[model samples]
Target: MAFWIFLPITLSAVSLIGCWTVYGLALRFNHICSLRNWEYSNSCLTNKTVTGGCCTEYNIPTISGSGTQFPENSLFSATINAASFLFVIFSIFHYAHILKKCTVHRFFSKSAMVFGCLAGVGAFVAGNCNPGELMFLHYLGSALSFVCICFYTVLLTFLTSTCILTGLERFLYPVRIVFSIVQVTLTILYCIFFTQKDFYYRHISAIFEWTLSMNLELFELSYAVEFYFFSSSMLSVLLSNRDEENTMILS
Candidate 1:
C-alpha cells in the first residue's frame, strides 16, 4: 500500500528534526558552545549554569555532547531510541521486500538484515547510555552502530544494483552507490577527526558527524520509493517459520 511509504518518510523526518531540535535546545540552554563562536573563550562557554554557578569550557558541539545536559538530554535519548526502533522495522521490511521481489542473492540479503539489526541495537545502546555518565559504553555503542550501518548500506546498495526489487533500479542503484561511498568516507573522516586534540580538528569532526547522520537519513528516505510497493503480508511471511509452526502444532 502507498500508505506504507510513510514508515521510511517518518523515520527520516523524525530523526533529522528531533536531533536538530535537541541541538537547538542545547544551544539555548547553554549545554554546549555555539557553532558560530565554537571556541573556549576565557574558560567560559556559557553564562548559564546547570549545576554550580561555574561555567565550564567546552569544544564544538557534537550531537552526543549537545545532549549531555538536562531537558535536551531527554529529547536526544528519545529521538535516538525512536530512530533505532524505526531502523529495525525498516530493516525487516527491506528484507521482506527482497524476499518477495527476488529469489537470488540470499546471502547478501541475510547479511544486510543481520548488519541492519545490529546497527539498530547499537543505536539503542548509544541512546540509553549517556556519554557523560557512561562514556565507554556510549562510545562502544556508537562505534558499533556506525560500522554496522556502513556495512548495511554497502550491502543494500549492492542488492539494489543486482536485484529487481523496484523497476526504478536504474535510478536507485547509482544514487545508493553514491550515498554508500559518502557514508563510508565521512565515517572514516569522523573517526580520524574524533581522535584529534586541536580545536579545529575537533570542530571539523563534529561537522563530519552531523553530515554523516544527515546523509544516513537521506539514504533511508530514498527507500520510501520501495515502500510504496510494499505490503504487510511480505513481512508476515518473512517472520513466519514453517518448521517452527509444524513443531508447535505437533507438540
Candidate 2:
C-alpha cells in the first residue's frame, strides 16, 4: 500500500525530468537548425525528404521529414509520447495493486481503475495520432488524451481530498489541497481552451496556429500534480505514525 503511492510519484518525476531534458535539447537543436536553415524531420530523424520537409522561411520547423535531423520541438514531442506511454503503464500497474489491497474506499479503488483504463486508451489513441497532421482524427486523439488526463486528475483530487477530510493524516493536507487545486484548474482550462471547437479553431488557431504543439506545458503540469500527490501520500503515512505515537504516549 505504501509503495503504491510512491510508484506514480516516482514515475511522474522521471517523466517530468525526461520531458524537461527533451525540451531543452529540442530548443537547442532548434537554435542550431535555425542558423543552418534546417529543421527536424517529423515522425523520426530519417534523412529522406518528404512533403513540408524544409524549415519554413520564418524559421519554424515542420513536423515531418527525414529522420536524419530532428528539431527541438519534434524531439520533445517524441519524448513526451514515449514518457506518457510509460507513465500510463505504471499507472495501470499501480492501480491494479491498489485494487488487490482494497484498503482505500471502494469508490476510490473503482475510480482509480476507471482512470487507469482511460489513461491507457488515451495513450493508444494519441500514439496513432500523427503530430504533423491537422486531421480530425489527430485532433480527436489529442482530445481523448486530454479527457483522460482530466478524469484521472479529478479522481486523484477527490481521493486526496477524502484522505485529508477524513483525518487520515494532518501534515500533508496543505500539499494535497494545493495539488488538487492546480490539477482541477489545469483540467478546466484545458477543456475550455484546447478541447472545445470554438477555442481550438477560432482562438487557438487564429492566434498561435501551433497551440496544440505547445501542449508540453500541460504535460508538465500533469506530471507535477502526480508527483505532489504521491509525495503527500507518503508524508501522510509518516504523519499517521507520529499521531499514533502521541496517542499511545498520552494514554
Candidate 3:
C-alpha cells in the first residue's frame, strides 16, 4: 500500500518541482515572455532600459522557450531531463502495479508502460541534446517522445475506462477520456504548426507544445487521488478472494 501510493506522489512532486524550477530560473533571470505572442519577447528587454517605464516587450504568460533561451538554458535542460528520468521510472512502476491489481487489460496496460518508458527516454535524449548543438538527435528524440506519449495516453485512457478494479470507475473513466482526446488533439495541432517557417506559426506551435507538456504533468498529478485509494482497494480484493476460498474449503 505504501509503495503503491508513493508512485503517484513521486510523479506529481517531481513534475511540479521540475516545472517550477524552470519557471524560477526564468523569473530569476527576468526572462518572462508570453506563450501566445506573435513575437518571442523576454524580460531581457524589459530590464534593459525603462526611461518612462513602458517596456512594450513585457509580457506575462511565460512561453516555454524563454526558459531555454540563454543564461539558464543548460540548467533548464539538466533539471528537466533529471526529472523526466525519475518520472519515467515512476510511470513504469505505476503501470506495472496497476497490471498486478487489474489483469483485465494486461496487454494494453503493459504496452502503455513500455511506451511511457520509451517516451521518457526520448525526452531525456531530446533535453540533453540541446537543439542548438545536436539538432538531429534532439529532433529525433522529440518525435519519438511525442508519438509514444500520444499512444501512452490513449492506452491509459482505455485502462481507466475498463473500470475493472473497484472504486475507480468514477475517478478514471470519463475524466481521462476527455483529457486523452484533448491531448491527442493538441498533439496533432503541434505537429502541423511546429514545422511552419512563419514566425507566427512557430509561436503558436510553442504554445501548443507547452500546453501539451503541462497537461501531461497535471495528468500525472491527478493520479494522486487514484493512488491513495487504489492500494487499499487492491489489497481488499486479494484478501477477499483468499478468505472466500478458505471458507469454502472449511465447509
Candidate 4:
C-alpha cells in the first residue's frame, strides 16, 4: 500500500523536475529565440523577448522542442510520455485493487479506469505529436489529455471522499476537492486563452498551462501520507489481516 503511493509520488517528482530542467536548458541554448524568457509565445519570432530567457511557447506540448536539439527535444518528449503512461497504468492497478477490496460497483471503478487509460493515451499522443510538426494532432491530444486528466482527478477525489477504501484519510477529501477544482479551472482557461492570436493572451495561457501541470504534479505528491502508512515491500497487496480489517471497517 505504501509503495503504491511512494512510486507515483517519486514518478511525479522525477517527471516534473526532468521536464523543467530540459525545457529550461533548451530555452537557454536557443540563440534564435530572440530573448531568453519563460512566457508562452504564439510564434518564435526572433524579436520576442521575456524577462528570464528566450521563450517560444506555442502550446505546453511544444515544450519538448525547447531544447532546439534532437537530444533535448526527443529526450523531453520521451520522458514525458513514458512517465505519463507508467504512472497512469500503475495507478489503474492500484485503484483497481482498492475497488476490489471495497467491493465497489463496477461502474465507479470502470469510469476511473477508462478515463485514466485515456489520459495516458492522450499524453502519449500529445508527447509524440510535436506542435512544430503536427499542430492539429498535438493540440487534439493536449485537449484530450487535459480534459480527461481533470475528470480523472475529480473522480479519484470523490472516491477518497467516500471513505470506503482503506489506507486513505478522511481529512484529505476536501483538500483533494480543492486541488481538483483548481486543475479543472486552469484547464478550461488555458484552452480558451491558449488559442488566442494576441500575445498577452497566449502568454497568459502558457502560464495557465504551466500552472495546471505543476498542480497535477503537486497533487501527486500529497500521497506521502498514504506512503507513510504502510511499508514499501509488497505493500500493495499486503493489506491488514482479517482481524485488523474487522477493526478498521467503518460499518
Using alpha carbons, what is the TM-score of model 2? 0.51
In the range 56-160, model 2's lDDT, one tens digit per residue, is 222233221111134444454565466566666555543433433335675674565577566656644554454455456555765666566556655655555
Q: Which candidate number would show the highest TM-score if scored against the true structure? A: 1
Model 3, 116-230: lDDT tens digits are 8998888888777766578799789888888988898888878777745546667667877777887899999988987776646765676787788778876776676556655
Ranking by TM-score: 1, 4, 3, 2
Residue 229 local lDDT, model 1: 94
- Evaluate all candidate structures by whole-model CA lDDT and list the values in order: 0.86, 0.45, 0.67, 0.65
Q: For every model shown, what is its TM-score relative to the native structure?
A: 0.90, 0.51, 0.74, 0.76
| Candidates 1 and 4 compared by TM-score, better number | 1
Clash count for candidate 2 is 10
Greater-lDDT candidate between 1 and 3: 1
Candidate 3: where are CA atoms >4 Å away?
Answer: 2-6, 27-33, 40-64, 67-70, 229-251
What are the C-alpha RMSDs, in order, of all predicted structures?
Answer: 3.7, 11.1, 7.8, 6.9
Tens digit of per-residue lDDT, candidate 1, span 1-251: 89999999999998999999999998887676665554444354344442223334353678888888888999999999999999999998899889888889988998999999999999889889998789999999999999999999999999998888669999999999999999999999999998987777787888899989999999999999999999888876575644656889999
Model 1 CA deviation exceeding 4 Å by range? 41-59, 240-251
Task: State which candidate, 2 or 3, has the greater TM-score.
Answer: 3
For each of the candidates, give the backbone clash count: 0, 10, 0, 8
